[model samples]
Target: MTRIIQLSDPHIVPEGTLCYGVVDTGKALQQAVATINRNLPLWGKVDMVIVTGDITDFGTAEEYARFRSIMADLALPVRVVPGNHDLRENMRTAFQDQDWMPESGGINWSAEFSDFGLICLDTLVEGHHHGELQPDALAFLSDTLKNLGSKPVVVGMHHPPFNTGIIPMDINNLRDSAELSKIIESHPAEVRLVCGHVHRSVTRSFGKAIGLIAPGTSHTVTIDQRVENPHTLSLEPGAFMMHEWRDDGIVSHIIAGNYSDERHPFTTPV
Candidate 1:
């Protein structure tokens, strides 16, 4: 079994800074790390931790520095992809030593594990919140999938390929989604697409694969579907995901951040 933890959209800032003069993104992320470490003993061996995107609120060098400091505690192999809120150059600079990362272009790359191959595609469109699948990104994905053959694969990105019903977010969702769907549909293997830009948990069917949207670690977006107003962020319980690949198939679980009064012994029912 290959166990993977998915932490996304922490939007971490410098140690003393607050995001938007409201959310203490740095503290939120710190709490999240504590939460994960607390639960690690229960989950057993976690192969790696994948940060889907939006790692920093401003995508600044200082923020990335803080990000590095916090993630270093995990002491596990860490893989990341850029989100709309991220700057490609700085992100590459922050993790340049990772031999798997591409030196140029969209930052698309792949990694191999005991039970699955991870194919991470870059959907970051630089100056926009919306994501794009340019020619180069698509080509890289197609080639990676073809090379991986029939192995169970998890395609990680920063944007969901389908609209999530949140009007403001949908406006900035992945563009040319059909083209991406076509590529995944043609693949001859069980593929699961996991991403994090939505800030809320959602599941959608993407052609022949399952697409999962992981919750943000800092905050969650309100799930309002009406198109008459701007979307809002909420202080709801932040969360992450755990993707467990067993011999049968892949099972993804949503893990709420911060553990306190929720703990209880698993005593069998009388």
Candidate 2:
């Protein structure tokens, strides 16, 4: 079995800095890291760790440095993609050692672990909050899927391919998504599309595949279906997603900091 931990929208800033002058993203990430380490014994093994996007509140060299510092404790292989809040060159330079990443062009990449393929598409539109899959990115996706035919794939991107109901976020969702859907529809094997940017967990269907939005590690957007603007952030518990790939199929579990009274640890095993 292959397991992957998906962390999204961490929004890590430079030391002593915060996001929006309110969120202590750095502290939030530290807590998240601790939780992951604490639960490692129970989860057994994790093949790799992938951060969908928005690695920093601002795409700065300092922020990336801070991000690397915090993530260094994971002690596992890590992969990443660019989000709307990210700058291509900075991200590429920050993770230059990742041989899978291309030196030029979009940050799209593909890697195989066991029988599963991890395909990451770059959906970043620098200087803009909305995302788009340009011709080049589309071609890359087509080629990657064609080459990996018949193998189950996990597609990672920064923006969701479907509307998330949160008006503020939906306004910045992936553009030209129909083209992406067509490609997924043409694929033979089962594909799972996992993404960030919604900052909340939401599920939808993408052609024959399932589109999953992982919650943010720092904070989450308030879910107000009736409101015209869904820009408000909440102090809700942080969370992440774990995707388990087995011979039968892929199962996704959303793990949050919140657990009920029955979930508390005991000194003696019952």
Candidate 3:
């Protein structure tokens, strides 16, 4: 089985208040890490870790450094793409060894692990929180899929390519998503397309394939059935996704830190 761990929308803040709101990002994220480490089933099989984007509160160099420091304990292989909140120059400067990072200032990349392909897309459009794959990126994806047709493929990004009717969020979806969906639908060989930035867990159909939105490690956006202007910020447990790929298919799980009643070793009868 091929194991892929996904950590997204961490929104690691600098040294003060939360990003754009009133969430306890630092504390929530800490809980998220603990949750993943403890809840992951078959932990020994985890092979690769992919961080979709929004690694920092802002696209600052120092924030990346702090983010890296916080991730030091994972000791697993990881790759990243930029989010709307990220800066390409600063990200490159801080994470120079991430070979998958695109040259030419794009930061998109494709990688291989255990005979499976991991495609990281650059969705940051410089000045917008909404993401769209440009012509070059679309071409890159088509070519990559054509060349590695039979491999189990996992694509990660910072934006959901579909509309969820959450007025504020859907307005910021991937621009040419219909075309992209058709491309993915025609390819039955692909396993899954995973993304972040929505701060929620959802599954949508893309032709014959599945698109997954992993939860954020920092905060969450509530779901409202009457969501006309539906934009809300609330504290949810931090979460990360674990995907295990075998001959049967890809089995995925989301692990988080907020276990309501799991007793820690240090917790006595108190």
Q: For candidate 3, lDDT tens digit of each residue in 1-270?
A: 678888888877775766776866666666665655655553766677778888887888778887777776565776788888888788888878766665575777887767578778888887888998877777777788877778778888888888776667777877778777766665658558999888888899766768899988877877653657648876766677888776767878887646764556865675
Best candidate (score: TM-score): 1
Worst 10 residues of 3 by lDDT: 33-42
Which of 1 and 2 is the better model by TM-score?
1
Give the winner by TM-score: 1 or 3: 1
Query: In candidate 1, what are the lDDT values of residues 1-270, reduced to their tens digit?
Result: 898889999998878777767788877777877888888888889888899999998899988889989888776788899999899999999988888667888888888777888888889988899999889989988998888888888999998988888989988988888888998988887899999898999999989999999999878888989878477888887889999887768889998877683676889878
Off by over 4 Å in 3: 38-41, 225-227, 260-270
| Ordering by TM-score | 1, 2, 3
The runs of at least 3 residues in candidate 2 whose Cα sits more than 4 Å from the true structure, single-residue gaps closed, are 257-270
- Runs in model 1 with CA error above 4 Å? 266-270
Per-residue accuracy of model 2 over 129-151 as CA lDDT, tens digit each: 99998888889889988988788
TM-score of model 2 vs. true structure: 0.93
Per-candidate local distance difference test: 0.87, 0.88, 0.77
User: TM-score of each candidate?
Assistant: 0.95, 0.93, 0.88
Worst 10 residues of 1 by lDDT: 256-265
